[model samples]
Target: MAPGIIEMLIVGFAVGLTGALAPGPTLVAAINSTLKSGWKAGPLVTLGHAIAEIFMIVFILTGLYVFLGEYSLFVVIVGGIALIVFGALTTLDAKNASVDLSKSPDNAGNPVVAGIVTSASNPYFWIWWFTVGSALLLTAVSGGVIVFLAFIIGHWAADLGWFTLVSTGVHRGRFLLKQREYRILLTACGFFLIGFGIYFLISGMNL
Candidate 1:
């Protein structure tokens, strides 16, 4: 049986939170931007992230549905490979990154642009949309359009909440989150990405 709207929302929120917590370009960007600006950076970046997600949701709900429905395996393979490459690149970048807030600008660039570009470049973002996201979307469609909308709202809420907290904490306690700590976190996230990438590759091969 299909899950109800409430259940769908809960599931969406949980999944979204899980995705958000995972170390990725988006998280790194948020932290870096917040360090330069303030807590407001978090929400601004999230706004861009949310916009990208909204576009993906619409595309999935529309004509992409037919493509995914028919060529599911193809989509998986492509997405999986993309994840692997992205993961490797992310790891390398993190390893060589310099965390120097001293040189950071008061206002680097538009958070919205940062969010959009960061999100658009991240391969794992698309992978999630193609895999877990696609599953949630299918379930939501089964329940109803209202359920789908609920899922989107719940997911985005998680993103906004988590990033807001992160940015706020960083902005308030910048000294606590020093350069070394930031690099460590970035490195950890990079490894996590690589692990997820390997999993995706295997899953794709199996498919």
Candidate 2:
């Protein structure tokens, strides 16, 4: 038997958390904003991320779905390769990255806009939407719009939960996430992405 709405939701949440934990521009922005603006930045950034995702979801559902359906294998292969490259780059970046709270911008604009712009500017964001995200949406759609909506909610919930936790911890604990801890966390996330990328590559080849 096929999975139900709950299962899809769980899948969505897992995927979202994985994506959020991965070191990326948006994650950087979230951390930066939080240091400057406090814990409130977390939710605001997520809200903006969600807004950007909403439009992306709609576009994938309506227009990109057709093209993806036609070239599914090719798209998956390219996406998988891209993921591998991204993983490598992330790993390298983690080794050198340092979080200097002292450098936090004093004039960082609205967190919501920061979220939207950061998300939009990232090429990987669109790439994931086209490949992994599109595939996930197709699965969710099998159960109906409501199920798909639930998947979206689950995904955003992970984003919100993670960013909020990070922001709150940074704001409250202040000394919890040192540069070494940050690098370790990002390195772990990079490995995760690499694992996922390998899986995607294998799956694409099988197709």
Candidate 3:
């Protein structure tokens, strides 16, 4: 069955949260900025990330989908495959993932700029847009613009919420997230991604 608008929103948030929790350049930049600045760095950084993604959204929505036309359904298949691969990798890496918030990199620069540069420069970001993001977006658009907007809202919420928590915890020296907890969360998200990938593949083939 095709997922409804609410489902899309929920799925978007879940997937976005998984992405946010992963160790990446953007997250590192946010941590460095938070250690140097304050809790505000997380949201500010996410804002810049959102800014960079706006162009990606425009490109995928206006060009990629339109160009793909009838073959767009295959995007779902590709996205499912990518998700499975990403999930397996995430799960395997979770056992060893360690975040060091104390080691602030001097070159973090402005939190916003770091977010933009790190996100835009990462090759995986584009790959994600071409696969997972595009597939999820196409699924959302199938339900109409309102549904698509819901998905965006959910995704942004996760990004903002996760980063804010990380920054706040770091700035306050709370050190709330330990390695064990982080690994568990990653493992859960990895399994969730795999499950979602299966569902997406089934939906795509049937749709």
lDDT of 1 by residue, 1-207 (tens): 444788768756755765665566677677878877789988998999999987988888786677676765665556556545544655566555543333354445777778888898998788778765775576577667888888888888888987887788778865345556555665565565556546645654565
* Model 1, residue 181: C-alpha shift (Å): 14
**What alpha-carbon RMSD in Å does predicted model 3 have with respect to the real structure?**
1.3
Q: Candidates 1 and 3: which is better by TM-score? A: 3
User: Which residue runs does candidate 3 get wrong by more than 4 Å?
Assistant: none
| TM-score of candidate 3 against the unseen true structure | 0.95
| Candidate 2 Cα RMSD (Å) | 3.5
For candidate 2, report its TM-score. Answer: 0.74
Q: What Cα-based lDDT does every candidate model obtain? A: 0.70, 0.77, 0.86
- Against the true structure, whose TM-score is highest? 3
- For candidate 1, give the lDDT of residue 43: 96
**Candidate 1: residue 85 lDDT (0-100):** 59
Rank ordering of all candidates by lDDT, starting from the highest: 3, 2, 1
lDDT of 2: 0.77
